[model samples]
Target chain A: MNQSRNRLVFLALILLGIGFVALVRSTVNEYILSIINFVGIYIILAVSLNITNGFTGLFSLGHPGFMAIGGYVTAILTFPVSRKSMFLELPQWLANLEMPFFPASIIGGVCAAMMALVVGLPVLRLRGHYLAVATLGFLIIVQVLITNWDSVTRGPLGLNGLPAITNLWYVYPWVVVTVYVAWKIKFSSYGRSMLSIREDDMAAQCLGVNLFRTRVAALVIGAFFAGIAGGLWAHLVTAITPTSFSLILAFYIVVMVVVGGAGSISGAFIAAIIFSVLTEIFRPLEENLDVYGIGEIFTAAILILILIYRPQGLFGSREPGFLLTRDTQ
Target chain B: MASSNSVLLKVEGLEKRFGGIIALADYDVEIRPGELVGLIGPNGAGKTTVFNLLSGVLKPNQGRIVFNGQDITRLRPDQNAALGIARTFQNIRIFKELSVIDNVKVAFHIRMGHGFWKTLMHTSDYRYSENEMEQKSHEILELFDLEAIKDQPAKNLPYGIQRRVEIARAMATMPKLLLLDEPSAGLNTGETDELVKTLRKIHDTYGLTIFIVEHDMKLIMTICQRIQVIDRGRMLSTGTPEDVRHDQRVIEAYLGKSGHGKQYAQG
Candidate 1:
């Protein structure tokens, strides 16, 4: 009976999502539609980062590096052949290549996950602030590498005028997938081990949890989705640059996770939408209203207030379902 | 007493040093299957160090640790757990943020039968394994009378209850040898008596080989059949509780080298 009820809820959610997508696509106002699309992308980023930072209790600040990897990989794969040729530094074999958005994004995500696997092996061993610093260093390294790599990345000028392939349709599905995967992981045995490590590493290890393997797995999974979010962002803006995936962007993503309550996927989703919308609404104020940097200052203030008043964030790590339902069964 | 032939754990010539100070030196112990042993020493006697070494929290500089006939001297903590050893901490280390049931479920992680794909897809195999884990966790919780508070966060529980949850979590790992460090450290006399009853019940039900490091003499003396005493990182005496109770070295270690040793030994 419970399984049937769950299936019913799943079907309803899919139908609702399709209806919402149709409504957004049919709407004539492009600006509002783009803002909604950005929210979906941020949701993906926040939820994925939460898997590592909140669920696994690893304070990683390397999402921007993985995003840059995804953005560049997708941009390179999907860029028109005619435009690709404009870059004289591009290799002859690569300059003519162009692929569908689907395959490019998949490759982008896979590439980011691969990087996470390589870096996480050594870096995930460090805890707390050290891990954060190490991951931030990774971001810096990626940024520097991208800045220096003149042939593919266009030497910090970044790729521009790429196909506008991302929309609400492309992004919302990825959000659903990210949320689903994260929710599944949170309840799984592996996720339990991760949580135990977060609570007490020595106790977790003594309970047969392989610390290195679990930490690395969390990082890789998180990187995979962050990469996908990057692909969506690159396509939505029709541009890619090293500065696009900066430390500031990483901070925004971290703030989303913190404000959403780290371990709660629903919390991340809600916080992502609210913060993205708030930033967009404040963007015009910063430009036309002569209040430069107001959006950033406001966000920083909100983050500080939330940390001071609700250290566990809005939801305090409890899932929406858990809050609604009293009994576990 | 169980025969030496059925020994579940054997430690020999164990040595650990933190710079100049020797934390443990020439530490030796043998625990047979189904034997309840107590390791007692005053502050800085390396009682907790022995637990740490046995459970693979720390590696000994010179030693051989054989557990269930396997040499686990260089094994990591997870490897030790996989080889049928589990432990609790001197300080309560339950996952405070997690639910009481989840505290036990996390320990059951090693035994989960589902793969990553099954878990992500929520396949029937995943459900089956999850249900089994929950049932097992419930059973363990029930054993500690924690079923009523199973849904509460572990941190919300009282100290005594949190200690019980830690033991339940440790047991969920399905260990053959259980090492508990100061399980009764912060409990009141009433809680300590209840803990003794619970420990006795756990030992009898699981038929486990338990090695406990405790400062509470009354609790350890009542429960442990044989006790090992250490002083300043060296073995002072090893015998039954009654024998150790009256041993001159054990008495001297606890009451000092004055006439109080004899006076205390009389008790």
Candidate 2:
């Protein structure tokens, strides 16, 4: 009975997604559609980062590095031959390459996951703040490399004039997939093991959880989604650069996860949508009203207020169902 | 009575040190199958250290710990668990945020057959294993009289109940040998009596070789068939409970060597 209900809910979601795609495609205002697309991408980023930071209790600030890897890889792969020759200094075989957005984004995700595996082996061993600092260092290193690698990345000039392939059709499906995967894993034994590690490492280990292996797996999975989000963001903007994935973007994603409650997938999704909309709403206030940095100040205020009032974030490590009823009590 | 030749655990010359302080030195222990053994000593006597070494929470500088038939001296905690040895902590270490049922289900993780893909997709095999685990967890919870409160977070339970849940969680691993560290530490006399009954019932039902480190002399004396005494990281005595209770060296270690110390034993 529960399985059939789950299937019903999944079927309803797919139908809703189809309707949403049609709605966005027929909408006349491009600005609203763009905002919706950005929200979808942020949802993926926030939810994926929550898998490691919130669920596994591994505080990582390396999402920007993985995003940079994904964004650049997808951008390079999907760039037209004429555009690549005009901007990028590349090998003959490589310069002539082009692929569809779907496959390029997947390869971008794979590349990011591979990097996560390599970086996670050593960094995941560090606990708490040390782990956070090491990952932050990784983001900085990636940015620096991108800034200096002129032949491949065009150095500080950045890459532009790529196809604007990210829309509701591309972004919404990934949003659904990300939420579906996160929700499924959150209820599975693998998720329970991750949560156990978060609660208590020694006890979790005594319960037969391989700490390093679980931690690494969470990082790889989270990185894969972050990479995909980056690819989407790059195509939506039709440009790519090292600065696109700076510490600031990483901090915003982390804020979304924390403000949504780290371990709660629904919390991340809601928080991402709310924050993205707020950013857009406040954009006019900052630009038209000439209030420089007003949007950032407002975001900081909201975060601080949320921290003081509800330290566990809006959901406090609980699923959205918890709000429908007091099941825990 | 079990034969002395059918040994389940054998630890020889276990020595551990932390910089200048000797935590445990030249410790030797043996437990026959179906035996309930107790290791008792005063504070800082390395009782918990022995448990740490046996469960692979810490490695001894010198020792050979053989459990069942495997040399587990250098094994990791999860590896030791996989080899059919499980333990609880001195301080209650139940996963506080998880429900009572989940705390037990976590222990059943090692035996779970479903891989990542199957679990994510909720394949039929995954459903079967998960249902089996839930049924088994419920049975264990029922055995501990915790089934009613199984859905509540473990930390929300009372201290005595929390202790019971910890042991129940340990039992969910289906261990051949169980090591309990100060299981009766926070319990009152009534709770201690209940704990003793539960331990005996668990031992009998599971046919497990049980080793315990405890300070509650009453619980130990009432349940344990044999007792090993340690003081300042050295072995003081090893004998039947009645024998150790009457031994001069064991009495001396707990009550001191002087005649004035007799009051402690009586008290």
Top candidate on DockQ is: 1
lDDT of 1 by residue, B193-239 (tens): 88999999999998888999988888888899999999999999999
DockQ per model, Cα: 0.74, 0.62
- Give the fraction of true interface contacts kept by model 2: 0.59
Tens-digit lDDT string for candidate 2 (A1-329)? 35665567678878988997897779658888888899999999999999999989999999989988999999999999877887878999889999999999999999999999999998999999999999999999999999999999998878888799998889988988888888777776778888889989888888788888999999999999989988999999999888999888887888898899979888998999998898899998889988887767877888899899998898877775522223222
Model 1, residue B33: C-alpha shift (Å): 0.5
Model 2 ranges off by over 4 Å: A322-329, B1-4, B260-263
DockQ of candidate model 1: 0.74
